[model samples]
Target: MSHTSTMISEDIEAYLKEHEQKDLLRFITCGSVDDGKSTLIGRLLHDSKMIYEDQLAAITQASKTSGTTGDAVDLALLVDGLQSEREQGITIDVAYRFFSTDKRKFIIADTPGHEQYTRNMATGASTASLAVLLIDARYGVQTQTRRHSFIADLLGIQHLVVAINKMDLVDYSQERYDEIVAEYQVIADKLGARDIRFVPLSALKGDNVVNRSEAMDWYEGPAMLELLETVEITHDQNRRDLRLPVQYVNRPNLDFRGYCGTLAAGVMSPGQRVRALPSGKVSTVARLVTWDGDLEVAYPGQAITVTLEDEIDISRGDWLVAEDDEVPLANGFEADIVWMHETALEPDKLYDLKLATRDVAGKVKAIDYQVDVNTLEQRHADHLDLNAIARCQLELTAPVPVDDYRTSPGTGSFIIIDRLTNITVGAGMIHRPLDSELPYEFREHDSKANVVWNRASVTQAMREHLKGHSGKCVWFTGLSGSGKSSLANALEVELNRRGYHTMLLDGDNIRHGLCKDLGMGEADRAENIRRVGEVARLFAEAGIIVITAFISPFRADRDAARELFNDGDFIEVHVDTPLDICEQRDPKGLYHKAREGKIRDFTGINSPYEVPKAAEVTVNTEFMNQQEVINLLLKAL
Candidate 1:
């Protein structure tokens, strides 16, 4: 029966509008094995008149063969729909059911209670606002109870209801219910669970599930349904930080281009300034469009299409956030992982890590410790086994925006997929970002040495204001004779003429002074590039437009240089003159000597030069003149 069956017959549209206005609460029921989680849900549905007659009759018939209760209707058969579940009288997989009362609608996840399916329970609890932790009155509290409680707390389920079921077995004993509540409260205190409420019920006999049980008159609290309907979950959402991860670009015609996604947090309105991540483009929200019409304001969880005032580059998997929000962009972080695969976690193996809509390859760099769910003890382990929970450090191929899982679960949680099989093998909650590129020797020195970094009283903003321009890094990378040096020098001269504070770091000039001791071998060349990159970064920090011309061959070394600056500050200009042109223009005769094996490991001759994959500007010096190249670099800048 519908909650508004009379209104549905009288005014169908009005009924729908009323139904849509009602808030939804998602909760999960979980505990130890055979703790009557399914039974409790079935009782809630039956006693509240949420179940239909046909479904009730079907379960009444199923009660004859598979019912655990003797000669009584088996309500547990309502949610235990699987044949294996009915036969074994246990929930193996997560089962969801939807029902509503006059006050609020609910979607309940009846998660499995067995130790083997703890991962299933975690999956169900990931999005729930409340958790109904069922404990058998006879057993008090079990190991699985603590494990589930800890996981629920870790997943940020702040509301908890410790439902002590099978109270009739204890003859409605208030002492037993009190004892169980006292025992579970200790664990709850350890977990720091908030808004905990205790309810005594007999799932089989329907005591205090929906209707207050007359047998337990000593209990003065409201029923389970009452507490669920009135719990304050409105403030649970993160309403301060605005995030909308772009899921699709809705471009129906030339005039229409709207970024479509659900608001993950906070509120949005017209004229609100937002920034596109990974690009750092800022634009104001022009309009908020939904399927029905344009909205005046949008809140979290509303699926809407947003139009920006400026035409900037935004694509799927990019994030739109408030311009001032301090979202972290990290390539490595520490996370708590729940390993779900049978194969143990291998630290060196690469796996597909997915957070929100963004997917990238990453590795579990190290396991900090494995948590014993029973005792909440941290034990050191190299790898994680099946259903093992541990804190591990992860390294990703590229940096993406991240948040702490405790404060923002929507953007902070991630999953690990097997590389070959593509099966989701583990789930993780991010703790914090780790320093990504620190070498072991440097880390040891930092720990042992007493060197401290001194802070300058003058800020970078003040320096930029004094210089009348923002600092930048124009990095030119290509073959030795590919006109990189010529382009860098010309661009620096043009910028200097324009009254911009500029510093030019040329490859040959640096070798004569700063890197005179470095050789031409691979390791020495890498160290040489690292030194130049650091000097360029320092110059850029001093509010100077730093220009660099180097045959930085390795992509990894170049990426390290790029990481030293903020996004959009590092501009890589690839001088794409062909290798033949570069060799022909070899003014120093180095290419000719390398052809005769005089200069060994020379770039583009014996050594390799990895071309820039995503350069901001690519100019062919063979076709374009020095003035044209300088103009192009200035335009990009």
Candidate 2:
């Protein structure tokens, strides 16, 4: 038997004997282009006797055709399989390889080393438990080295191994390796890469990779292979909050219904009380099932279908989480994205933000900052190009529950898909959810596909032109009995008499039908205004002047409604009336009930009213009568 084959046989035999005790370790190798990343992985596979006989022969033959190292068998050919990759002698895609040792099994992601392929590297690092960052011994610590380390730190990979490669070019000198390690330590510390280990080895000669080489007798640390076989990774996942994003609903026939998804974190049992989000329905798990059998308990990374005790509604993209989880409900966020597309990201252009299994309307609200690749400092940028890393404020038209990536990775990482071409344009990690008083618009887009996104035919301008007047929404805001609904009704009657199309959306009339399901709370009030704004926009689109008379007390909520319309289309008319006059003229007796403590969240009573500071039209109801106010509004419109 060949010497390499003998070693393979021994390792396989040992692994078989200790298979029950072994654990899997996932790691990625990354650094600057031409820094021997692929070669080092190939050398590790070769020296550890992991490759098959025919595979070794194919690489040996491929070396003769186009190899970086002359005469000797090119090991990099084993991992760099693409035509463009082998032609340029660089890795353009993430190549994953599986191999085993007696102590542990490993999944190694051979990521791209070029600066332009930073997105490709991020894809590999997203799930890595450890990062084997390579640095060229000849060049010392370079830009790519710092970038990989920074990204690894950003992705929350705690364990880092800095492999200073090509030591043979520098005569395997301990001093040169130490110099590079010292330089890297400064940057790693700045980036908060705490658990770091450094090693020096020559990949071409297969020294200090699998076997401890006598050439580096000055080095007494473990070999790279030994470190992989022993590093613990059982506790890498967040195990506190049990998260299972419903991926599929497994239903076979009339008798069966199950909610199926992979357990993203924590353990699951048959009787645990789980709450499904976006709906917030609570239920108990009836059965913890799998294809093999019914499991008594399931851990993270296990795929299982859970049957709820109650017939609660659960669907795809709904999160079945622990009832007491600290996950934040987010409609907008400011995240760091690695722009992967070639075209520069345009400002305010809508993209589909796909998180886990859900896709929502998203756009780059603002470019907060970008990283200077060399200086490692945050710099202001307006747009991002290919492989550009920047922190952008992502504005979503809808909200979802989020856990910070540092705490829970499965719920925090996402990608932006181009709505036109359906291509993945960027990858992002949510740093925190935006907590402004008014959140982003979470509405879905209604554009048809296969061309530039437009509403197709019957444009808003055409509708307005046919009506002989510009369609608009005159939104009246004030406390109850403050002449808001009366003014809106009179305005609607006046517009109708003047041969203009009009519709009146009164607060009580809307709550009876369109908003029948909503309750009287702060969130419900915001949603009420949002729905009213949507209806007003649709009415105006049909060439009708919409008059919404809701006591939208919060200025923030009113501002969010304004964003739903074109400029000048939303005319905020504040019906200025004092609290005492509003109390004296209680039309619905709501003020009397509020004063008697029978009503909760009644505007101008328990719920505070934030009067408009810069409303377009201000009508002092204390002085101006109904006729004067109607005439004033007609002239303004």
Top TM-score model: 1
Per-model CA lDDT versus the true structure: 0.89, 0.86
Model 1, 1-637: lDDT tens digits are 5354788789989987888889899999999888999989998888888889999899889999999888888888988899999999999889999998887899999999887887889899998999999999999999989989998998899999999999999999999998998898888778756689999999888889888999999999999999999999999999899889888999999999999998888899999999999788999999999989999999988999999999999998889999999887888889999999999999979999998778889999878778898778877677998888999989899998888888778888899999999999999999988754343232223246666455543557657766778899999999978898878888888888889999999999999999999999999999998898889888888999999999899999999899989999999998889999988989899999999999999989899989888999999989999988887877898
| Weakest lDDT window of 10 consecutive positions for candidate 1 | 437-446
Per-residue C-alpha lDDT of model 2 across residues 307-336, encoded as one tens digit per residue? 988998888888999877766777787788
- Sequence-dependent TM-score of model 2: 0.66
The best candidate by lDDT is 1
